[model samples]
Target: MSAFEPRPPFYLGIDLGGTNIKSGVVEDSGRPLSSVSIETQADLGPVVGVENLAEAGRLAVQQSGLKWDQIAAVGLGSPGTMDLSRGMLLEPPNLPGWNQLPIRDLLAAKLDKPTILQNDANAAAFGEYWAGAGRNTRSLVLFTLGTGVGCGIISDERIIEGRHSHGGECGHIIIQMENGRRCACGAYGHLEAYASATALVKRAHELLAEQSTRSSLREIPAEELTSRAINEAADAGDGLARRLMRETSYYLAVGAVTLMHTIDPDIVLFGGGMIAAGSTFLEDIRQHIQKMAFPTVAKGCKIEYAELGGDAGFIGAAGCARAAFGR
Candidate 1:
């Protein structure tokens, strides 16, 4: 390379999860140049965890055919109750014993570069807003439906990192006033209790035990019943399975409508493994939203599926870093 050629800005983004640390080097244009993944081994604690995250970023830069100094900044997205201003991890249910640590600065020191911390779901939402489903949209809301429901809101290309870093936690919104299913967080009547993949599976079991109607789901062992299994059954014309799927869609729509009325985002996206339920499932949610929400709110919001798949986290984290460094 000639000295006359200006250096292009690149950023490294690391998404730290309970099972894996995913990192990627992303170009200024929002394309991922390269990515690397490593076992989190989170049980080993924050010290080793930070080391692993730094290693993943190093490997990502090397894989992207760039030197470490080429990275303008690093973004670390993690799950937990966090203090965004201080970059402290207050409490993460999955990462026990990792409380009260300044994770943002710790990772920055490990990499010897400037860094930023973001909530994992927020990072993913920004990824979509930057280059995925919500591209070109002024405001976006994302719901990640997996073991539990996770939400992230982006308005005017900025993440809504609330005062205490709990701004976009829409999953805990109360949807039921009476006796409701319990959320893993020990909360009752939360949207997650009704809409998450875990909740779907739990409801299927309860319905199977209560209803005398024979269905294909009964053939599968109780332990093997998954949201995927139920979806497949529904596709195969099982009445109970279809009903469960419809109810799941209704629950998701309830959550979406609440957000729509509150935020009035231009677009809303649904993501995670459960999205495999496909277009019909999405249509179901749309129908429910149209019924429950104001006509203006329902018609104005463009509801769709997320486009980034598993890569949203790292890419969005990189996007956040780029935004922070004024790239």
Candidate 2:
């Protein structure tokens, strides 16, 4: 490196969520220079929401000591069904009064830069693939287990967005065809029905009501029960809680094995609030993967936790922008 070497162009990434908008400035090398977080206040309306979204990006650039024009391009990651070809949000359950909004073009016009839009989950995966856990690998799959299960896939350094933007939706994969619990999406036996944080809490209530097990969980009120509480009880060696956690691991393993066989990714990552349960939960998933998957598939792929946390979405969006416009 020398003083004469030219600096790589910068990019801006905006992650629009139901509650908050996160934006960051990033270099071509995947290093984020600055980030800004602001309340989305989506209930106000799309016009204000998009205005705030652009302001967040501009503030991030200001924090980075760069001019708006210095950004090579901009990227936005949003939750909801969208027509990627048209850059319009179709329907996002979390975002009200924002249906059919051309969010991509709105942001582009505000910032006056080339903008690209991506699904929030896919953007998170690209962030990891570009600079986080899977930085060393060419391909990986990420499962985010929170209020609901969300998935993202990257193969050969490209997002598997599918022809109609339905790719990487591994959360809905059916693990049970028989009589199984219903998912929020109205599907029965989907992995989210059994493996997400919401599912774990619901199952805990069912177990407590159906069985008179002498466990610590019975002490917690039904309304206050949460996956984190269950994890804590399991950490304290509560039998019923431990059993529930193990069952969750098994369900997640079933989903992972299915993806491994189909995508043959180099690594599999588990993210979201559940990963905070620590190494035991990850080991449980790995063990189940070994038992259910073919040796060649299970043994070859690395199953690990996602490195990026809340910052993944914006960073990954920046990565996508870099890929599309850095050259």
Cα displacement (Å) at residue 225, model 1: 0.4
The parts of candidate 2 lying over 4 Å away from their true place are 1-7
Each prediction's Cα lDDT score? 0.92, 0.92
Alpha-carbon deviation at 131 in model 2, angstroms = 0.8
lDDT of 1 by residue, 20-63 (tens): 99999887778888889999989999899889998899999999
lDDT of 2: 0.92
Return the TM-score for each candidate structure: 0.96, 0.96
RMSD of 2: 1.9
Lowest lDDT sum, 10 consecutive residues, model 2, at 1-10
